[model samples]
Target: MDLNTTKSLVTSKTFWGAAVAVAASVAGLAGFTVSAADQITLVDQIDRLIAVAGAGYAIYGRVVANRKIG
Candidate 1:
């Protein structure tokens, strides 16, 4: 799949998987071990947080716009 054509980064499984891997590696470097299941949970939470932030930004943009939606 071409990442360039993807509408949103949060919708990509590969992106989330990589994020989990990076998180695990960072935690390991900090002397904290994160289990596989915990890593999976972290991916889900991060995905949700990003999605929510995007939605919130969209709403804020609309509210602050000078013109009404058609």
Candidate 2:
């Protein structure tokens, strides 16, 4: 991606906010699972997807930085 796109993705508040939200959701899932077993299935699946996307976003910054350094 271009520099602007790289900067925007890495520095954007929305991106990091979503990452934090996903992490919190996953953390809550453990304690909430027993009570809401039915809904946990779908929510857990969605959380996994969001986590993957969030990981990719965070990694993009490192990959870009590595390219510049190496």
Q: How well is each residue in 1-70 modelled by candidate 1, as lDDT tens digits?
A: 5746646767766799898899899989999999999988877888788889889999999999999889
On lDDT, the leading prediction is 1
- Could you estimate the TM-score for every candidate? 0.73, 0.36
Q: Which ten residues in a row are the worst by lDDT in model 2?
A: 32-41
Tens digit of per-residue lDDT, candidate 2, span 1-70: 4745554354455565565566657868866433344345545666577678889978987877745654
lDDT of 2: 0.60
The best candidate by TM-score is: 1
Candidate 1 residue-wise lDDT at 14: 72
lDDT of 1: 0.85
lDDT of 2 at 67: 58
Relative to the true structure, candidate 2 has a C-alpha RMSD (angstroms) of 11.4
lDDT of each: 0.85, 0.60
